[model samples]
Target: MKSRHVIFPSLMIIFGALSLYFISQFAEPRFQDASVDAKFFS
Candidate 1:
């Protein structure tokens, strides 16, 4: 039961990192009128 608590959050962090890396690969450049870059939001 104690291990379950640690495992879940660790898995969440790993998955979140993986997803961010995957999404960043497809990020586009900033728009002409936008102040921030597209990757910043991605």
Candidate 2:
């Protein structure tokens, strides 16, 4: 039971890193993103 407490956080960090890696790999980068951010800020 005590071992699981350590294992859970480690697994969570690994999975979170993997998800971010794939998202950055295939995600689109566009110039229009500045337009969206401007709208959000203003």
Candidate 3:
């Protein structure tokens, strides 16, 4: 049946979730102030 084509949404959800996770994993945290010395101590 043509209903078998419904796999696209499932694939999209899976890929979207993975993409979000991968993006967050590589995202750099921005500091509110660049003068913070805690960044260097960490």
Q: Specify the highest-lDDT model's number.
A: 2
lDDT of 2 by residue, 1-42 (tens): 999999999999999999999866654453255677446545
Candidate 3, 26: how far from true, in Å? 0.1
Q: Candidate 1, overall lDDT? A: 0.74
Off by over 4 Å in 2: 29-42
Could you tell me every candidate's TM-score relative to the true structure? 0.63, 0.63, 0.54
The numbered model that scores best in TM-score is: 1
Runs of candidate 1 with Cα error greater than 4 angstroms are 29-42
Clash pairs (backbone) in predicted model 3: none
Mark the 10 consecutive residues where model 1 has the least summed lDDT. Answer: 26-35
On a 0 to 100 scale, what is the lDDT of residue 9 in model 3? Answer: 79
After the best TM-score superposition of candidate 2, give how far the Cα of residue 1 lies from its true spot, in angstroms: 1.4
TM-score: model 3 vs. ground truth = 0.54
Between 2 and 3, whose TM-score is larger? 2
In model 3, what lDDT does residue 33 have?
44
